[model samples]
Target: MIYVDPSGDDSGPGTVERPFATLQRARDAARPGTVVTLRAGTHRLTDTFLLTAAHSGTVYQAHGYGTPYQEKVVISGGREVTGWTPSGDGTHRADAPGPAPRQLYADGLRVERAALSLDGHTLRRTAGGYTVEGTGPQRWDGDVEFVYRGAYPWSEGRCRVASVSGDAHATTLTMADPAFAQATRLYHSVLTWEGPGAGESYGVDSPTSVENSPAFLTEGTFATAGPVIHYRPRGGEPPAGVAAPVLETLLHARGAHDLTFRGITFADATWLRPSTPQGFLHYHGNGYYDGGALETVTFAEGQGQVTVPGDHASMPGNLIFEDTSRTTLEGCRFVRLGAVALEFRGAGAGNTVRDSEITDIAGGGLVIGDGARDHRVENNHIHHIGLDYRGSPAVLVTGARDTVIAHNEVADVPHAGIVVYEGRGTKVLNNLVHDTMRVLADGGGIYVSGPQGDSHANGALIRGNVVRDTITPYNFGLYTDYGAAYVTVEANAVHRADAPVVLTVWPPLEHVTFLGNVWDADPGDPPGGVVLKDNTTVAGDAFDSDPRAVAITRAAGRRPARHRH
Candidate 1:
């Protein structure tokens, strides 16, 4: 067992008596199964500590030795070494002014080369020294030693050059020929110069050119590269792949038998970058092939943003479980996403998602199926989604089997609340769907459609669901077509200002059952036949001789039965 303080004096024996000064020293001294405990405090590092196969079983734990709240540990990157105070003088001197400060400059800091981590202290720049203010005996701030130096083109002109070297380094800016600064004022710009070595300059309207070129006022001559780029004055959009900087995802698993995360919160400002292909978390195609138990993790994106590209069919913040088995997600939340929240794809089986909340999405919420089988979805809250396009449903299922959806609350979606297409043995029960079609051309609460030749969805049971406040140009609470068969609808509550439900079978339905349902609005005169037994319609007149339509006598509290027209 070796102790690495990262901030302690290096003169000791790397133990309690004389501790090692850096994390890398402890990592180098440890054996294969060693546990390195990092004392709680900000331990700034100059580089990213990449763990390879050799460090597989190595446990790097950060624990507080003193007050729990006061202990913190942080690793950082890309810091520049300033002047250090001598032991006798007890005063510091400037070391070549380090990197140029940004528009806002605060000093008295520790600089490193690569990634940095801060623990148990607030990191804020100050005039004298970087303030690591909090509380605890284990609190300290120091930078790990690493050096990375890269050069960019320096055109002789009046333009501000802003550059971020690597990770955990602040952006630095310098004005080229500061006297002529008025002729060129840079703002959120990047300039690329093709010379002996390709160099780049970044800032607002910064300039770069080929060779040791004196800076010239050349318009549209510089290009920049990185994760983020914002043009000023007119305030143009960021480049395609740019996103806010933040540590993205964290995972904890117990063993190879598949660890499960039931109720976890994943929150960050840059959870999903709008112009980039980054979500908070993604787990797809990492599990068993023969439907073995895979790792299951649920993310509640609390006040986070997720972006998906416009050209892709899938949405952002989506969790796709492909060819996995026995995974479930319940009681999660999603907001401001580009696509569906959860998608089961490519022969995935035995998955379930229930009692979750999805909102503010550019696309619809839940999409199960598309080569998935034997899934259950129940008791979810899906609302306020699908602003971009039409025909986005709250729940869409296609090519699935043995799926049961029940007791869900869906509202304020664009197209249909629930849609089932091309599958078998699906049971939808006791769901409350309302306020659908805020932005759709035509909408329905429930729509079931099948493929061209194949009969759509056999042995489906839709019962005891409530449909209300669906206002669309072509509205229907429930519509089934495209050679559907053997679907039973019973004991449902539907209320609409317009038409409530429409049962249209193009090739005609076979063996469909409708029974014991209460309709506030009628299906008109002569409701069709299958089995319309024990049904009560609020409409004044009943259908006459419709094969699928049944008449029922209304009682005070008993279940209605189908009556012959």
Candidate 2:
């Protein structure tokens, strides 16, 4: 076992007494089957360190000794700094004559000098003294005094504080006040108290605003309600012509079979960027062929921590897989993203995702096939997804076979909860789908569509799923179109929705079965090329207008035995 410390001596043997100075040196000296241990401290990394495919059976361990909490290592690419010059106006002046400017700290929020008044509390050379409603003002004889929570950007020795009114109430501040031309705006960093109640600490992106200025004031009431609080800028329009940043993915294999990463955190704080591009982390054919097998990778965020700017839309398509096999991801969280969370495109098989949380996404949550097959998605908690366009399914499976979807909780999406398109021999069972299609039209809990041309989707089993609280301008709970054939829907519970099921067949479906399903809403008249057998409904009447030439038997007050075909 060779111990390496990047900050320690390089002249001695690579042991605890005298460690290797650089990680590159330790990696170079290590052969296959070598366990290289990193010292228990922060190792600041710069540039990409490539562990090539040659070093097989080598485990590069970081912070492996001592208590796990005490062993800390941060691998970062360092910080990027940009220079700024003060305008030397009345609000900005050189307080100290030195190479580095004198630093000042403040408590209130930061705004422009033009928004300040004689009775207002500003950070401009103030030896603080005032009386608000007989309460003596707190005195701060410093060069810079903060009125509210301050804004800390990546600049050096400069911050802005919010202004206070004569009554000791904080005023709404703006970034358009000429003092913030080249400034970075940190949103909603204020602490407020109403009367004798406990103070509330607002997060950075509270008080939603839609102004064009960089800093929009937040919305909050004083001890007594004042003007409507709305002066902040909502982050929507991409900063002029600056396109979103592109995320670069680097994958390396070190002769290890079964490389997996689970419960990792990836977040972006800047606006005008998509956080990440579509398919940020992807693996296709290289890692496995080079004596490595990547399996069971999970990427999720921590609880209650908002990863992106609250005003912007959700991020998109964080993970994509192609030709990888037997992977599973569950109990994860995604927010403020654009496209799908986990997507498998091209010839992958046997993946499963369940019991996870996905929300605030513009696109769908899980899409299981462009060419993949035999996937199972079960028991997931999916909500607040599909905010972008219409027709986005929370779980969409296309061009896949023998897939099983069961026991999941899905809601608040813009499209259908589960959609099986161009897939054969798939089963959707015992799931609860509700509150879908929030924005656009064409909503449904489950939609099954067939493939075009010579490819036919045959033999699907849809059973025992509960559909509720679905609302849209158009559509139904279960819809089939084109050449979909041999589908079985049985013993399902649907409640409080318009248009429960609509089956449309253009090319004449073959051997369709609807059995023992209970519908609380009006079960619409079935179309042609469908069969209904012994289906029980609470609304006594069989069908509004039967379009299919099949037997419809209703057995009420009698318990029906479970039947399987």
Evaluated against the true structure, the overall lDDT of model 2 is 0.44
lDDT (10s digit) by residue, model 2, range 1-565: 6776758765667887788876666667777667666765433333234454444345555443223342433232222111212232212122111111111111111111111112332322222212233212222112122121112110011122223334354223321211222121222122233343123222222211111111221221000001111111113211111111112211222222212222221211111121111101111100001112222211222111111122222222445555555554433344433446556666666766654556655456777775677787776677776443233467877778788887777888766778777667788887778887554444467777674213225478887777766776565766655466777877776655666676554454655667777674545566566777676555434332222211221211112222110
Q: Give the TM-score of candidate 2.
A: 0.48
Cα-based lDDT at residue 351, candidate 2: 69
**1-565: candidate 1 lDDT, tens digit per residue:** 5666766765666776566777667766766666565664445443434333334445454443222342344342223323332222222222322122110001211111112222232433222112223332111112111101111111111112221122233322222222113222211122233343223222212222111011110211111123111111112221121112122212211111111222222111112221221111111111001111223121122212111112223332334455545555543454434445456666666777655566655455777766667788776677876543234578877778877777777888866788887677777777878888554433478766553122324477777777767876667776655455667777776666256666544445555566776666766542253455676665534332222232221111112221111
User: What lDDT score goes with residue 35 in model 2?
Assistant: 63
In model 2, the Cα lDDT at residue 548 comes to 21
Clashes of each: 50, 25
TM of each candidate vs. truth: 0.45, 0.48
